[model samples]
Target: MKQNYIYIILFISFIFVTLYIYSSEIKEPLEDYDETKNPKLVFNGHWSGLFCNINRLVNFLVLYPNTREIDFNVLASKTHHKPFIGENIEIFSKLFQKYKEDIPIDTTYNYDGLDFTKFDLTHRKAYEYYNENRYKLEPYNKAFNKYLHLLPHLQERLDKMVNEMRSDCQQVIGVFVRSNALADEQPTGIMPTREEYLEAISKLDTFSKKTKYFLRIDNEEDYEFYKSKLSPIYETNIKRAKSNKGDAPHASGEYLSLEDLENTYLEIALLSHCDILVHCVSNMASAALYMNMNLVSICVSKPAAQ
Candidate 1:
């Protein structure tokens, strides 16, 4: 019996040693976004913030082939599936949790279509080509929008919540006002103002006694400011995102934890259901545009004034 036990222990040790050797042999070439050269074309970027980063991902994927890995470590803090603002971490898996195909790519092979392995973010010439010439959506890429879909569990929860919010049966409109924590962050020479919002609201001929609105603004004060200014006949719903110091609204505060990120996305998803979108130049609005391409945008700012 003693001899048999010794032999079994030796066999297990051999197996583990072999596995470790194989793992170490595997090369993670472009581990971070800055390196940029990968055997497979890695779609990655810095964390400009949630919706903005997602827009970059979606827009790039829309024009590219489907068989690439989302290099989640770009601005991510850790390689694991958590939201680390100081670092990107692998939040992609957590954010788009339900996607099951063409993801978690193998290191063995590349996509069958156009090979952009040599290209990186510093080169954006391809975007100019596709944007001007062949901007039309191909059937295969139409599902690219699904890339950012919420996990099944969150979807079910939000669906019920959104349904209840809209149960009053009204003409619902979503308004996204873009602002951030720093006063200097507002776009120079073209910041959106109360006057612009009022002018946009006045043109919403669809507003009636039954009309309801969802204001997905940057700050709680802005939320109430817009809410009070809009016609009294309409109702307003605002998602109270957890305060991040002054980075309220849809921003990740000092830290980007999983819960804060999830709520920000939830606000975007729920806003997609609105009958119309009155917005500033916001990536959150771009997210709603993902769901309804034809939705009318009431641009709160007038370029003529600028």
Candidate 2:
């Protein structure tokens, strides 16, 4: 009886190992597309989720070539909106069903099994448009609205700065201070003095006397002059962003290049990771409001350029 029991145990162990090996060989489906096999579909809706959402949809089309249907209509003006919602999903579904002869995707994508919240357009005219076209616009709008709610919950949603970069042995805090570049350059206004900057920093010192702070600035030379007075633990390259190439309207007469704009985005992401933000009346301050941080945020509202 003992020998028979040992044989049965060994057989069960061998079966389990074989199944594990077989499962390991089964690769996960990658998210990718071959534009040729599945033709490209123009994405018409609000472009916010255009790049990311379309990219994923294309991958689905490629994976299930026979079942996935392409709809260029969603990319049309009739469908796309500044804030996408629900009706768009139904339209997309109908288009897909036309080609596949069956519904391959769920009419609604339940987020973590929870029903998504409806979109609330702050702009009255836009809200009216959505209501009038509810059958055509609801789904896409709902998806985007759901995304807005989920954004604040991400762990690394606010880009990491000093806190995220700190080594296991060292600890630091990253700080972002901003003002409208155009505001100071206007003929009527003047840049604040080093004394003013120091005074503001001193006020914030009550939060942490020992926290190391890294200063980020758009104008490298301007910040250099204040470095000694401000006593920042570290400072990022101002013109370092100039190495990359692209352009955005700049108040300083010259436009910011692609590299410059991208660097600014990265810098903000890191700054938002900080425990606190000391802002002046600048767009960067507006960005901090969007980022949900755990620390107390003390923002100094700067007057708009007169």
Candidate 3:
């Protein structure tokens, strides 16, 4: 009876050790296998602006290399006010050519069992991810160049605008001013004052009578102000906020038609063609940088603003 009792205890101990090893080692590998084999990221359209959304998409592709596919259907459903169906498809078709048929705006499909990582578009979180993987981000510029391509018609329009500017000016300096209610939307003193922008532009090597300024300001007041200060300013006929009191025309309750969004993108693309860009830290600036990696940028905003 004593020997039998000892044998029973040993058997129980063996079983417990086996279970512990399986839980600690075998189970984790199985989960990792699932993640690596079919990793999917979902975008829920958390951001408002067009470039903000584009930046989020670019961040995901750069940060997560194992991402086999992404679901923009959720983004499409959430962004009814700013419809991203056609433009979003056009953008992603270049990135994921193999999965073209899989990319559609379907909100009803069940994604229950498939484990997915949701992309959060907040600036702080994005920066944190960028810092954590800074060493591996050498491909960031390459990724942007590979993925972000303007539509053919838009590209043609941008070329024509550049040619027109070149005809009149020895150097085309792009100036992006985030004036008006963006200050209210962002932190205090984040937006550079009029004096600061003027000072930055004045310091540029190409600042001369022969240099033309390409303005991308949010409100008409700044538009007129810069046009007065920097003569021969060229701007597209896109909508601008009438006053400094309200949100930007696009961000305000005003309906942003497809043309408005395309014009916004066109402005950014045009900025890429400039000899130098003087701006603050905004999505527009970042998008322009992505479009032209070698474009010289002079940020007049405070360093903390970034």
Candidate 4:
């Protein structure tokens, strides 16, 4: 029995040694890829926020291909599935308490509100307090970092669009018009009248006798309304983007639904294509400044209501 026990002990020690050697041989140091080394393409919309959660996820899968270390949870809160500045976080806090997970970090950014003394300051302060208390949304930082990694690529996308527009028009003047007409909602600020739009174009035409303008808006209704108002002013030189519907509206009152694809991406692309951007108090106009660095930015102030 003693001899048998000794032999068994020796066999176990040999097995351990063999397993350690095999493990050492199989292990390799992980390599980190610098995402910023290449250009990036940002895909987002108004509801998507600065870091488009879904679009970025897709981009990661397509761009990284083999990267497995990229963990989305490490960056964003589980509540991010339905993100709102202050409202959703409250719901998340309640859920977190029930689950007893590690406390989340606060990640509140800046905001500009129309009212401060009233309910506005209360809302802003709540967000600030939340930022002070919660786990910071680390994903935004990662997303922004990845965005910087592909800045050159995004710049290239911008450059390509610029070159194409320049070739199409003798001179390209980007026209950004307000788009609050959703469900008959009025846009804030002093919107340019038809005459004003024509006057602006007339002034631009002086730069090039055959100057053409690129107009971007949310809905086809606004596009047609503006086009009809401007055609007599710019004549046949006027080129509005063809409606994806493959048919034109019969009159000013006609409405057309926009493509269901992300509105934020369309807004960003439209703003990027502009040489000069005109915007109102709409959220897209508010956030446009952050996304498009090269455009000449202009904000039309909202008119006071009676």
For candidate 3, the lDDT comes to 0.59
Compare the candidates by lDDT and give the number of the best one: 3
Best by TM-score: 3
List CA RMSD, all candidates.
12.9, 22.5, 9.0, 18.7
Q: After superposition, how far is residue 193 of candidate 4 from its true place, in Å?
A: 4.1
All models: lDDT?
0.53, 0.37, 0.59, 0.36
TM-score for each candidate, following the candidate numbering = 0.62, 0.39, 0.66, 0.38
Best-to-worst lDDT order: 3, 1, 2, 4
Task: Report the C-alpha lDDT of model 2 over 228-304, residue by residue, as the tens digit.
Answer: 55443554543532211211123323433434433444465456455555544333433332333343344333223
Q: Tens-digit lDDT track for model 3 on 1-306?
A: 999999999999999999987654422322333323345555444335556666656665555444555555323222333443343333333222322224333322122111224333223332222212322334556656554456677667778988887777788888888754454332343568899999988887764458888898888888888889987877689888875555566555445555666777778878878878887666667667656655676766553354
Task: Rank all candidate structures by their TM-score, best first, as comma-separated numbers.
Answer: 3, 1, 2, 4
For candidate 1, write residues 1-306 as lDDT tens digits. 999999999999999999876543322222222222222334454435555556555554554444344444334543322245446455555667534354454443222112223322211222221212222323213544655566787788678867865777567777777654432332343556778776777777653547777777766667677777654323334445343235443333345566656667778777777777776555565556555554555645333323
Clashing residue pairs, candidate 1? Answer: 75-88, 76-87, 76-88, 76-89, 77-87, 77-88, 77-89, 78-89
TM-score of candidate 2 relative to the true fold: 0.39
Residue 291 local lDDT, model 1: 57
Runs with alpha carbons beyond 4 Å of true place in candidate 4: 1-162, 168-171, 181-196, 199-206, 229-267, 302-306
Local distance difference test, candidate 4:
0.36
Worst 10 residues of 4 by lDDT: 108-117
